[model samples]
Target: MAEIRVDKLHKAFGDFVAVRESDFTVRDGDFFCLLGPSGCGKTTTMRMIAGLELPTSGRILLDGEDVTFRRASHRDIAFVFQLFALYPHMNVRANIAFPLKAQGMPRGEIRTRVEEVARILRIAPLLDLPVSGLSSGDRQRVALGRAIVRQPKAFMMDEPLGALDAEFRELMCGELRALHDRLRATTVYVTHDQLEAMSMADTIAIMNEGVIEQVGTPRTVYEQPASLFVADFVGSPAMNFIPFRAALAEGAAEVRIDDVAVPVPPLREAVEDSELVLGVRPEHIELTDPNEAAPLRARVFGVEYMGTTQIVTLNPAGGGTLKARVSSELAVRAGDNVGLHLRPERLSVFRKRDGRALKSRLHEVPHG
Candidate 1:
């Protein structure tokens, strides 16, 4: 296992900048994920660390040894590409031994290393089978074995499971997590899939454009998103951002979104004439009785059943669209006026200008 530190990393192609000055560190034996949409420089960032791409300017350190100018082969890091690149002519065993062979290990040592890695990846049973006939899942396991045979300091996975179907992707996610747990390998997984990062990584770096929008554990990034982009990109169905004016009353604050009037989490100091955003997660909204007090009303527009829970889309009774995941038996069809109860405990308040969190007075309340 190794610690990876990327300091002031930057990448540029002629005139177009692919990555800007960025800094972050991945602890030894941690599963860290770099997440973002296409062309967000995530691949470029990963490549720089692997010595596959030279940073325009910056330093990459492996366990405190500067390796920015080191060759990819000299770095001794494993890379698993999005597509499996197994040699069709070789069997799984041979493929797994290829890395060892390239490193000039003794024949007997190569055989032992290959067998051990195959066992770790649970692909020993198919070692004698030709690589050409393996399923995608099996091929991926073989690819993993091939990478592990060399005993690299770290593993870099670039959407390695992107080729698998949904079911296989989900299954591989679990397998990958378990494998990492067992090996305690320092891993850097790059993906555009937020759900995968949220589920598998110990820490996630949410990148947008060319810079890291936020970096933290999955729970922190999801629960206390540093910015609006992080908030919108990390959650499923995404968090709702209702624009409202913050009104200071006698001792309370009110947020008016559409025709709905809801009490905003009180601010520590009065924020007069400021535009505030009332952000709530879909999972926090509940479908409730029409006569419920202080209920925000919305008409149902769509419903998606996910076996365990149903996603309910509502036409904001005020004027926007809101999505809430409810129980399958909640039973609300399109055009049904449903009341929603916002979970204040999970609600986030953001300033419209810079999307920074507003000061909350929740802790200053008179009683617990």
Candidate 2:
């Protein structure tokens, strides 16, 4: 297992810049994910790391050795692409053993390696099947099986679940996570799927427009996003942002929405503005009694009763749609009036100039 380091990486095509001066580290034996939307240079970055795409400038290091100019074969790594690039004619067992054969291993060693990986992936029974006849989920396991058969120093997987249905994707995620726990290889996974990154990665590198926005554990990045882009991408239904002005009301610093005044959370530094943006998660918005005089009152505009909770869309008593997650038994219908309450300190403050969260250590919300 080895740590991977990218320093001042730059990739360009003629006049276009695909990746900027990017830098990050994937710890030894850690599951690191490069996450972003499509055409955001995540693939380019991964290809560069794998020695498939040469950077316009900058160095790539594996275990403190420079492999920036090394050919893909010279670097000890295995890559599982988003598209399952399996050989159509090969049986599952042969496909898994192909890498070993390429290395000129004895037949006895190859069989042992292939059977070991097949058993690890629980695909030992499917070895005789041709690649073309397998389900998308099964095909994915074959691709991963091939990568791990050699026990490469580092593994790179790029959206290996894109071809599967939602149900299968969720199942594959669990399988990959468990497989990762056992292999403990230094792995770099690339995916635009935020949920996948959150669930599988030990460290997430959230990227946008080719530059890394933040690098941290899932919890820190989710609860305290460094910028507006991350806050919007990491959560379900997204965090609600209501632009408003800030001020001192009575003895507390507060944000004013129409006629309502709600106190701002305690911060590490005094805020620089009388005007700011407020960010709150849907789950943080609680449904209160209609008669309770909360700072804000919303009229339910629609309700999506998902199994465990309902996402109630609301138009503030003043106006503007905001989503709040409530219990299914709350018994609210479209057009019902619902009072809103929140832990004021849980509120996130972003600068009006650039939309970065103020540096504050939040007290964890007591799980209900």
Candidate 3:
């Protein structure tokens, strides 16, 4: 229901910086995700937005109003924690009505709000039960109900599904996204799990070491990572990096890796660094006969079978190990020598000096 903005937001605990000059926006009615590894400052950033923690420097704006120094209670933002923070002494109905009651709403109005939120969350049947006796999943629903009943300007969730088992977490992911769609509320979700972020977020801000690495739609972040850190952190198998030394002029079409001329997407700018890294996703690699002339060659070290595909581990002659996703139907075994062909259009070139991705044709166009 609001647009959230952070400008040069910085946080520090004495000498150690928890967040550094971060900047981003959560458009109104959008499901925005702050994604990263542990201690990457996502939680701190969210807290600042919710008015739970004061930023050491910079500004936080909610719906065009500065709330940087406002108290959490004054922000009109609801926060859901990873552990379902519900009152064990209270029944589900009472728990969900707590916020309205605290606001001194009429008793009848509180009852009406509680019932509406319970119905929306599909938790109406458990309204009379004690929260302590509920299942983890049910308790989580109650937590969500409590937050939803507030009708706040925005909602902030910090890995609300992290307490559930794998199966329940997956199931809740769908339920949560659907709830957002129904409410169309401005939601800021923080999580370290890439799968959750990729599956649920309308836009994702990938963070690391207190810095925002890249912010884009899920497909854009995955297909055209802005930096090396983003390329490795946003994928399951992660992008494979083939390290080599080369100096090239602008518009160069190819580079030599192990004396093999591997075609690459033309560079938009010259790369003066001799140390460069070639990044390719596992699914883009194709295995060919070793005897055939190809850009690169490797020996098959192992195969991991999935239902429709297999992961072929290879030891490239140019050094370093690589994995290829291939059809499981293809016959391949350990110790089999194979030539490797990378899809040229999908290649990413990065400078090792700063771990920054090089500007090239591959990144010039926006990914669908």
Judging by TM-score, tell me the better candidate of 1 and 3. Answer: 3
Clashes of each: 0, 0, 1
* TM, every model: 0.90, 0.92, 0.97
Residue-level lDDT of model 1, residues 9-78, one tens digit each, is 9999999888999899999999999999999999999999999999999999998899999999889899
lDDT (tens digit, per residue) of candidate 2 on 114-225: 9999999999999999999999999999999999998888998989998899999999999999999998889999999999999999999988988888898888788777
Q: Candidate 3 — which residues are off by over 4 angstroms?
A: none
Measured by TM-score, how close is model 2 to the native structure? 0.92
Identify the leading candidate in terms of lDDT: 3
Candidate 3 lDDT, tens digit per residue, 96-193? Answer: 99988889999989998899988998899999999999989999999999899999999999999999999999999999999999999999999999
- The 10 consecutive residues of candidate 2 with the worst lDDT sum are 359-368
TM-score of model 1 vs. true structure: 0.90
Q: Please report, in order, the local distance difference test score of every candidate based on alpha carbons.
A: 0.86, 0.87, 0.93
Ranking under TM-score, best-scoring first? 3, 2, 1
